[model samples]
Target: MNDSPGWASPGPAPSDGRPPENSGGSGPAGGAPESTPSGAKWSKEQPPAGQWSAPGTSGQRSHAQTPRPQGWNGAPQGGGWGAPGPGGWGGPPPAAKPGVIPLRPLGLGDILDGSVSTARAHWRTVLGVTVVVAVLVQIADIVLQRFVLPAPMEITADPESNPTEALRQSLESMQDSMISLVPSLLISTVGTLFTTALLTIVVSRSVLGRSVSLGDAWREAKPRLPHLLGLTLLLSVGAMAILTVAALPGLLLGSVGGALLSAFGVLAASVLVIWLWVRFSLASPALMLERQSIGQSLRRSAKLVQGSWWRVFGIQLVTALLTFLVSMIIVMLFSTIALFTDGSGMGELLTGNSPEFGWAFLVISSIGAVIAACITYPISAGVSVLLYIDQRIRREALDLDLARAAGLPGYGTEQPADHTPGS
Candidate 1:
């Protein structure tokens, strides 16, 4: 191999199992003759070999000999031909880094750092999309909580005096909780869908060291929104179905034994749901970047995750935990402040009453929610996109394609065309 970075070429392989002709051998003469094909050739008009000093030596060359031209035979001045330069002979070239990450298989740190770097580099676009989606979603949630959803049922039941009435009140409270939860869940899901789609584009461009705008991301992501929504709904329904099936038998039996069995079933079902969720976690990026059908994207994700399930799951879990912690901190701080500012909320807490939050409390808490969403959305989306890219780099040698796409030289001869994301 040549001793140059990014320009090394493989030597010719022997046609048969034997070594090539003229290669050095343990012969009486110590090797092949000077005329052999593999032997180094010397110029006819060469200076005396001993006259020039060896590279890196302090000894001076004979002044009688003529000075060689600067950068003779591609070597820097004062260096022997083919001598080692700053990088020693045959060292691997540094990976190309056009954007947030180097085009290579990524480690956990690389994945996390890349996500943050992408968001930081493209804060205008990244924050813009996330903030808008977060604000809209929070507004909808606040409106639903304050006006559309029913008020919290008063739990005035005294089980000692009226057991039946207490049971009925408990059921009503559960019903109200579900009613409130469903709308919030739906709103959050919609918000995630849009942010995921838009931020995926931003992250993709950032990987290629390119800047993108909110308009550009929307234009690129608009076509894939419906498919993404379908994917989200499909995953949600599948999980719900699993849980329902697990608990149905217990509910129908209405006995202690059946309830025990149902609990076990639900536990097992939860494990299965988690496994499947991680297995298909990369589907969103695959769908958006590859422009693939929902089925194909799921399959692609499964294939990428097949052997590295634990690694992918661990990375995703860590990301989720970090985001959750950050959001919790922000929400808790604001909620605490809100409690002090809203007299009714403070009174309800003090009296151990169900808090009927007023508009002041709701608006303050919503602001916290908006801020949390803005921070978490970009991070979550960035990690997902980067995980997908990391998996592809490991499995498909995607770094080469990424390097080419970034217009890095020495990767390929042909120029990259305008292809789909990840193509």
Candidate 2:
């Protein structure tokens, strides 16, 4: 039977082991007694194999009569499989693309493009969700920085004259920085959690060429939010615990050599953290899509990433770098404008003093941050979801399921064992 688009016909059934009834027989009863036709004689000289022309052909073989070059499957070759030809069967038909990406194992470009295309195609839902989340996060961060967080501690000790005092002040400054960073990190994490959950759903729908509304995304994502939060917190706490443990011995020693040892230990632990992060990176999507428990999702991600660690690492790393650059550019642009608008702030910064940012600078900078988050959130989420889908397609043949989910023609149809349909 001829194969249908997006479907391959089943092969013929296995043959029985028995030989044919008339095997090795020249005549009816396995005896050689057939008479030759009158005046027909075998020729002494024969043309080499594949060189002789059929009867009624001219001495010179016509182009139409010449045997067409055979393809790997013995079909007369035109442009080869999947290449455009007279009947469009020069090669296998193009992969069924029911959505942003073709239903097949994806390349890096395909994954990135699909992510952007999903955002572009479903901008209303994607941008709407990201914008709201980003705006809220930025506003909270601005408020925290402006009112809640302590001002930068002033350093008055002279380093040369009072080295101990200066060192104490420096440590206090570092402590203040970390203290201020905690709230911002928490706010950003919460925002990312919501956005990643909602956008995963949107991107998944877009992969099937289906449009989703913000409400639909929220509804679908809400059920999975708790598990997602647990996963996020688990990872965050795990990383912190590793770092803390790495630095604990050095902290106990409390000496310069101990400090160096702690730093080295932390650095080594960081490498381990990065490896673990990549190994379980797909857990979010797996949890959201498969409705797996956090533990199950982690295991699933590890299983999928088992043999493709570098690839997953490279894609995630590139995505993170690109998004960081884009966000920086946007933030810098707005920051420049804010500085120009707030002359005092710019003056303070230029004078090698900490800038006391007023409402104008804060608002403008926050606006820039909001915009950056809006642009990057969808892209980051899209890549994560698409990467998960791509991995599944590669390892689990997910394209067939995606095609079926998309309701594409000729996919996911089953035939009865005893009844084979003609092509």
Task: For candidate 2, report its TM-score.
Answer: 0.76
Q: What does candidate 1's lDDT look like per residue over 254-319, in tens digits?
A: 555666777899999999999999999999998888778899889878878988999999999999
- For model 1, the run of ten residues with the poorest summed lDDT: 1-10
TM-score of each: 0.75, 0.76
lDDT of each: 0.74, 0.74
Candidate 2 local distance difference test against the native:
0.74
Off by over 4 Å in 1: 1-91, 156-158, 161-172, 413-423
Q: Candidate 2, clashing residue pairs?
A: 80-90, 81-90, 81-91, 82-91, 82-92
Question: In angstroms, how far off is 89's CA in candidate 2?
Answer: 10
Stretches off by above 4 angstroms in model 2 are 1-91, 161-169, 413-423
Against the correct fold, how does model 1 do in TM-score? 0.75
